[model samples]
Target: MPNQRYTNQRNTEAPMQSSIENLSRAIFTVNRHAKTAPDPKFLYTLKRQALEKLLAEGKATKKGLHFSKNPKNSRQQSDVLVSAGEYFFHLPPTKEDFSELPHLGELNDHYRNPKANMSLSVAKTLLQQYANYYPTEDKKQPGKKTYQKPIFKRLGESY
Candidate 1:
């Protein structure tokens, strides 16, 4: 779940500046998966709206993003900030990229968990690490087929 601090109180309006910061951190964390997927799914309509709006505000950056205060308004039906770029619709899924629902559902699922939220900069670094860890190792087929090694694909390695 997202930090309750981000929640809106019925009678009190939280300070905007601090709320914005909280929203930033929260949004970044939630979008971490979006940054790391082999082929990112950034096609959601809401994400695109957020991205364009932030870009217009000159707030878009490789590591930083602008977010709405209470995103629930659109989803849970509450007035909340949806992170910028939260709605850029991705091209329709294809066998070439993936076989699934529209990018909107993909991005939404990534950010569905509050734990998913992490600062964009941190998320980017973490994603890079994950990619490096599971690099596509080169593979050489033996005269005969075999699949016994955990690291099955690599140069000059026998299974």
Candidate 2:
């Protein structure tokens, strides 16, 4: 009976460990592709939702904040650093994050995330499942077009 209990405990731990690893890999793949994706809104949303779920489950930790490399409108910005399963990622900081987490200054260019071999589609699917994210289709009315007046330039007039 003692031996059976020990084996059962080990069995449960193994799957949990592997699941975390798989999730981390999926996150890495999603993050990588999101950087260059033309329509990255959905990808970024998926990553953020997954990280939030992991944090809520006590599977991930907030490390600190780092200055964003690409600030919008030339204004300064920062992101929250999160650690999970030997992987690190940055999430958009909330108002509380500015007060609660210490700023880590600039991002480390030398450090890189571990290489993951998962496909983009697989990664998206895995994250969607884990994050419980269901994308809703945009409900635009068919054949609806807004008309714009055409601008005509006067011939040879600098006015």
- Sliding window of 10 residues with minimal summed lDDT for model 2: 9-18
Model 1 off-target regions past 4 Å? Answer: 1-20, 29-43, 62-159
Please list the C-alpha lDDT of all candidates, in the order they appear: 0.37, 0.86
Number of the top-ranking candidate, with lDDT as the measure = 2
> Candidate 2, residues 1-159: lDDT per residue as tens digits?
556553443332222223777888898999999999998888889999999999999999999999999999999999999998989999999999899999999999999888887778777878888898967788555886799998777998674
Question: CA lDDT of 136 in candidate 1?
Answer: 37
- For model 2, the stretches where C-alpha displacement exceeds 4 angstroms are 1-18, 139-159
C-alpha TM-score for every candidate: 0.22, 0.75
- Model 1 is weakest, by summed lDDT over 10 consecutive residues, at 97-106
Give per-residue CA lDDT, model 1, range 56-78, as digits (tens): 56554332122322454465221
Clash counts for all predictions = 31, 0
Error of 2 at 43 (Å): 0.6
